[model samples]
Target: MTGNTDVVVIGGGYAGVMAANRLTQRDDVTVTLINPRPTFVERIRLQQLVGGSDDAVVDYPDVLGEAVRLVVDSVIGIDAAGRSVTLATGATVGYDYLIYAVGSGSADPGVPGAAEFAYPIASLEEAQRLRPVVDAAPTTALVTVVGAGPTGIETAAELAEKGRTVTLVCGEVLGPYLHLKGRRSVAKRLAKLGVTVLEGPDAQVTAVTRDAVQLSGGRELRSTVTIWTAGFGVPDLAARSGLSTDALGRLLTDETLTSVDDMRITAAGDSAAPSDLPFRMSCQAATRIGAHAADTVLARIAVEQPRPINLGFFGQCISLGRRAGIFQFASKDDTANRFYLGGRPGAKLKEFVCKHTLKHLADEARKPGSLTWVKDDERRESLRAKRGEAPATAERAA
Candidate 1:
């Protein structure tokens, strides 16, 4: 903790930026964040952006603290043993510790021609690419959204509200995460908006084309636009780094968020799979994970005991349109853990949550290391050092 301790975060999303901000609070840590884009694209708001909202994105300078250095580059590989990251630009970053929060992307189900024919709104770039097609098409154009997750539901509802013919196709019932009451309410909203909902007992997407989608039921749904919002798949960076990953390529980490191979490396968000927790790919988990990662790094640097993360999702939110939504309550400490809230009231709550999350992160960026929510003692009592590990000091760049 004497010399310049470099902490390189391999992503710039919510978790990555928050980690960088938190680490920079200590005088000895020099935080470096690497991301492919220059601006902070709000992944949660991509559906809103596609539905014609420009208020979702924040300028990088506006979100990252002055002490946190930003590197607009792609990460090609990681050298865990040497504690270095290789960039697509051929530059290598040496770090005393690394935080992996590269996040996940849309999964292309091996359905025939799906990847080649369907459009995905997972990222800002993808949304930008789809905007023109949406605008050029006629008002009555048929737009099909695959996957009835939050993203799909939001996109379909938003489009239908915009006076377009929107059809939502899901392998399961609409908003499978919602409670029965919430699901029924959302279905009513879809019906009111004239949006078509197709459940996949027999209509699973088998093929996608520029002009149509072929379902397993042998029905060809004519679509001028096809938006995919299915599940997510982790990036290859974890596996490429030679770290242990789950079957889905998510890096497996101890409760302390440390990678299985190297305790000095931590991971969070959709890309990280904690040994104690099941699959949860939501912003609620990402925020807490980011804070926990920062605490782990800070504790290790200070030679203090690290803490364990116990954050949970209260419930889930699915936007039916710009003005309607359903908020399901759960026991997740961070989100609402109650029944469902819907209609204008639920939409207002959902909007508040989205805005508030960004605002909190933004405020944290301005004042790094101020969050006490992620207690240090939690890490120390939960994360015990593994035996037989050598003190890693290799300096060769990746």
Candidate 2:
């Protein structure tokens, strides 16, 4: 345990960068970040990218620590017993520890014709592909954004602001995570932007064609372009590598973020299911989980017992357009409260959050182990009780 510890982190999203940067805190530890892209994609800004406002990318030198080695490759398989990873380059990389941070992607819509017709903005490539498509379409083209989550709402608002006829089809409820007051604010803003908001069971999309979408109540809406953002699914790398995973393909881990199947392996971000209870897939959760995952690996390398995770939520910020947004406040457990900031102020706050996310990674790169977060004691206790474990000591750290 005294010589050196080599940790290979898969995926180069917010979580992967944070973990790699934080691991540099120890001089004895070497961190290698494996990713498919050389630059970091600000996933939260993909809507702006499609709207022709921003490019939604950052250089690796701006966010990743100088000490962290960057490997531009994809991990095809994980060899748990041999403690190595098989990369797409047909090379094997040995590691003392592995951090599974492969993020989530657009879920299969499952509806007929959806796979062939609908465009998704879940990743950078998808957003890039859709940008040109939107630019070439006529301004009056009928655009339909399926799903009512943050991604769907933001995409609808962005396109509507650009003078495209947009229809938001809420599968169940618009902003299902939003409180009543927050939802109302979004509804009003979307209405002002000339976006048609469709809610209720009848609004659910049953199927999609090349130029139209069919609703559940035997209704068909003419759509020149359809954008699907209903659900998210994680990569199957963990399952394919013979690691234990939840039903959704997220790596199963304990409260300490260590994989339940192998102590040498840990997980973070959207692809991690800690105690079978994964946090909501968002940048707000990803960065914190990434920091925690690094700390777990560092503790293990030092021959010290790692502490359990103690994460809390602040709120959800949804951008309506360039000029308006909604910052829905939440409790420690991430349940929306009645209070919110809407309109121009909310828009400014949302902009600040986006900038701060990038600033966070840059700061962590300069000052290793600088990021910190709040802890939800109640949620932690509930999870421990469900596992029939003893009460954990109240110890909180970055």
Candidate 3:
């Protein structure tokens, strides 16, 4: 054992768990993972949890490899130069390398009263608290969902199906990422499920309150419950650590997923910005980035050359209600290239993808760094060769 040569992973989300388990595969390194919660929260399925799904969470022990050490504590900050992290409990842990996978949270809409009155379905705890309030409200209670993105759409559809008068308010078109056909299909399903979608120019929400939501044009929507899922903002942990981060609080990393300031610290999932490629804030990217981050760390520890990230997001799968959804097919880069399936068939495919994502994690946890795909040195070399010498740009020209 490489005594004290431990990899410390921050956060217990998908990316963090995958990296820890992958690092544990090497006998030369010890993996210590720090997280605030004992169990890993399936953030993608938080909407399902709000819809009363009990299978949205997995116990950490059941999903983490035995070789990985789990510490339940919140990371307060990181001392990147000193190779240590300070915890909320006033304790410090040293590490040879670090992986930052502290995921994102719901973006607070800048509208007045929104923060105080709106409930966001971003975390498990938040969703759990929302369930009871929703379940107890009158069957005809009005529930307005701000933002017509996947999260907002799913929450509105689920609540509408539960007999609530749900309205989805969006400043732009519904499913802005979806093609016209897919968007129409989603709208159809929402209407059929008794969901009212207020989109287009007048869809802007100006304020939220306990009784109703006010739109930009002074239109008042009487609502008993208000949900805000307009956007997401990753925590400023990277900025806090004095690392290079984007305006959105995402750590700026190279294609190799290593922080620009220090290669010893890496980032993945929603918290990582891979140089220039647009990394979508979704589970598909999270899973692939997690695997790649692990590969990057393992390569460094095993003294093998690191692998380049080659992620291909097949599509976007969102559950509209209990039995309907829209599957917007896309290229490896997630640019909605086409639309393959929608409605029930699309919903089934979405379910399959979610199951496969968790199963991949489960398999990795059981084997502890046994993914054979990481050893493809040829692919890594080819990617590096393609990313050949950076041409003289205006910035470099100076």
Tens digits of per-residue lDDT, candidate 1, 154-238, equal 9999888889999899876887777677788889999999999999586588899889999888999999888888878879898
lDDT of 3 by residue, 134-153 (tens): 87888878888888888988
Give the poorly placed runs of model 1, Cα more than 4 Å off: 276-279, 333-338, 372-398
Model 3 residue 313 lDDT?
63
Candidate lDDT values, in order: 0.82, 0.94, 0.81
Q: Give the Å error, residue 141, model 2.
A: 0.5
Give TM-scores for every candidate, taking all chains together and pairing residue i with residue i: 0.90, 0.97, 0.91
What clash pairs does model 2 have? none
Identify the leading candidate in terms of TM-score.
Answer: 2
Q: What are the runs in model 2 whose C-alpha is more than 4 Å off?
A: 384-398
Candidate 2: residue 221 Cα off by (Å): 0.6
Query: Quick one: how many clashes does candidate 3 have?
Result: 0
Judging by lDDT, tell me the better candidate of 1 and 3. Answer: 1
Cα lDDT of candidate 2 equals 0.94
**Candidate 3 — worst ten consecutive residues by lDDT sum?**
373-382
Clashes of each: 13, 0, 0
Compared with the true structure, what per-residue lDDT tens digits does model 2 show for residues 14-47? 9999999999999989899999998999999999
